[model samples]
Target: MEDVLELYEQPYDPQQPVVCFDERPCQLIGDVRTPLPIKLGSARRVDYEYERHGMGNVFGYFDGLAQFCGRN
Candidate 1:
């Protein structure tokens, strides 16, 4: 990250363009119904099976001179 910043500052042109690349991973969760209620005193209940929806990876690009406010 520091290397990227240093490279951008070397040429130093306010009119020129610079962009940063970053990514984030997001997890999807599903709620399952329990067979026993907590008040019944029968050891908590949880489902052994689950369905996987999908995972997401978000890629974001930011304009260095634009207050870090650019997305694609």
Candidate 2:
């Protein structure tokens, strides 16, 4: 794990930018019921219920150099 963590310390190299990637399985969900419309003086309200559509994979990547100097 230390070896992986150390990759973050690498200096930014425009010619060879260090990159990190990860993927997470996520649930796709939506409101089971339509939200109640908001009125003049009331806050819009949504139902607490949700419906799962299916499973999804989310992928993300980061440029080590982009955050080397806290630029990102």
Candidate 3:
């Protein structure tokens, strides 16, 4: 839309900060077995099995001009 584009074209103002916010549901997972430690020539190995502990939300806020961010 023209209005949206115009908003983006405006110069940044610290006094009137513009913040963008977003959130999403995240799955909390954990490995079922202990992973093997890495050796001199070998890499660590982890099992494919995982347990879902619970669900949670991840939030993010950002201001492009001010280079500020907040998360939870």
Among these predictions, the greatest TM-score belongs to 3
Each model's lDDT comes to 0.67, 0.83, 0.78
Model 2 per-residue lDDT tens digits across residues 1-72: 999778766666666778778999999999989999999999999988999899999999988677766766
Better of 1 and 3 by lDDT: 3
User: Each model's TM-score?
Assistant: 0.49, 0.66, 0.67
Please state the error at residue 19 of candidate 2 in Å.
1.8
Q: Show model 2 residue runs off by greater than 4 Å.
A: 10-16, 66-72
The digit string of per-residue lDDT tens for model 1 on 1-72 reads 898768666653446657668999987766566466666646777787666678989999866655543322
Residue 57, candidate 2: Cα error in Å is 1.7
Which residue pairs collide in model 3, if any? none
Rate residue 7 of model 3 by lDDT: 61
lDDT of 1 at 58: 96
TM-score of 2: 0.66
Cα deviation of 40, candidate 2, in Å: 1.4
Residue 47, candidate 3: C-alpha displacement in angstroms: 0.5
